[model samples]
Target: MNENASSDVKAKRQILIGLSGGLSALADRMRSQHAIATKITTLAARAEAIAQRSWDLNKLNSQDLQRTMDGFVGEIKTFAKQAIDAAVRAGSEALLGKEVAEAIAAHSAEIARLTREIDSLPDAAAVRAILQPLSVTLNTLPARLKANTAMLKDVDAIGALATGLAERGDALAAGGTAGNRVAVELSRDLRQFAEEATTFSLKMASEAALAVKAISDMAQRTLGLSQGNPVSDQAPSATDRLMTLARTGPQAGQVWATSVSRTSRSSPVQGTPPGVKW
Candidate 1:
């Protein structure tokens, strides 16, 4: 019984340590994943800048080309969000418990918090200067290009348009490269996130197994000790071991209260009633 009690304490202590370590690991992974998300956001911003440049250049008259670039940028953002969501959800499912539900909720809330933080940033004067001009330029491009084409010769205008188209193509290609980077970073971080969560859960599970073994040993020892055992004057007797079991067993509080009642009833009291009420 003594050995079992010692083992149970050790097991409970190990379980606490394991849980603490696992939570620490999860916190670190969240930060790492957040860094990856930030990188993707930065790349997405660069891609948007490239697209904005392409739009400002007005080299391509085709709306379809512009739409394609816009679509690609949208896809990059969508894919980044989807990758994180899936990774978190997969990790939660792998753990398959209340903690799993809580983790998924935590990650979701974290993403939303990040989004709010981004939205709360003050608009930069420099970015506004560039983007406002680009918007005005795009808005007036058709008229400006048409007027210039009428003033210039057909051949000269065609040559100018071709140069503009080449520049726009280069900008679009740059945006595509940026989008690729976002995808790569997201994919790599997602795998790491899943692995970290899964590993932490497995370690926690192992600690839980130890806790179970200890409890089972404790129960067996409790029954065996109740039949009495040999002991010296210093060593724990059967009653001492039984008391220890009572402290850890179910209805511990009730048993403690009942013991206190019995002690009070047996002890000498100066002026206490025989049948005291709660």
Candidate 2:
């Protein structure tokens, strides 16, 4: 009878061991599923945000729009790369689990899609075309101002000439031949005054042109940065994700295992008699 009882106990232990193993496997599968789901959700959210930003940028003019669009494109690319790295790391953590690999592959596809979309956007040529007129106008402003200054200088000279002629005529009328010399001197002074006035007008025009040129240069630079070549290459790499997963997965697994062990230990054993007679 004792031998039979011993055999029964051994069989029960074997069953328990098999059940525990199965439960552990199930838990791991569930965890992997959760990780994948989380990753997918994250990627979707990122994509949505990127799309929205793109739409917003579309509303702006070429000069105003490209900066915002470029920023969004860069961010999307960066997020996608980061996601890929995370997936790779997660896969490594789960011992190269299928779910992790699937997630990573999905992210990679998304990144590629974003890249293509960004590349397909209108090139700087179109932007330049739009801005070229403005640039030309700006470039011409200084010359226009300078011409205006020259015209003003001529006006000043005319005014000065008029004043000197009037003075000389008055002196000649009052003192006749004796005032003649004085009149001639006054005439020379008037001519000098007219020339000074012309110079002043030209100076004003030059100053205005300079101011306009400065503003134009600033606007052009801003536009160039927005639509310029060689967009930033700040996306995350696959290796980065793998390393993160390596660091976090073991810790996560340990926490899960500990919780399971505790819960299992705490639970009352099955098949125990409710009321046993000793």
| Highest lDDT scorer | 2
- The residue pairs in collision within model 1 are none
Residue-level lDDT tens digits of model 2 in 1-278: 47855554444333323323332333343354345435534543444454344345435565554345345434534653554343333222222122222222223322233233333334434333433433343333223222222222333233333333444445534543354355345434433433432333233223223322323233233322333323232333566544434432223322111111111011111111111010
The estimated TM-scores of all candidates read 0.23, 0.27
Error of 1 at 36 (Å): 2.6
Per residue, candidate 1 scores C-alpha lDDT tens digits across 1-278 of 47855554444333323323333333333333234333433433444444444344344445654566565545534543443343332222221122221222222222222223322323333223323332343233223322121111221222222233333334444654354444344333333333332333233333223323322332233222222222121323445434543333224232111111111011111111111010
lDDT measured at residue 263 in model 2 versus the true structure, 0 to 100: 10
Prediction 2 TM-score vs. true: 0.27
Candidate 1 deviant stretches above 4 angstroms: 1-8, 58-278
Q: Give the C-alpha lDDT of model 2.
A: 0.34
Q: In order, what lDDT does every prediction score?
A: 0.32, 0.34
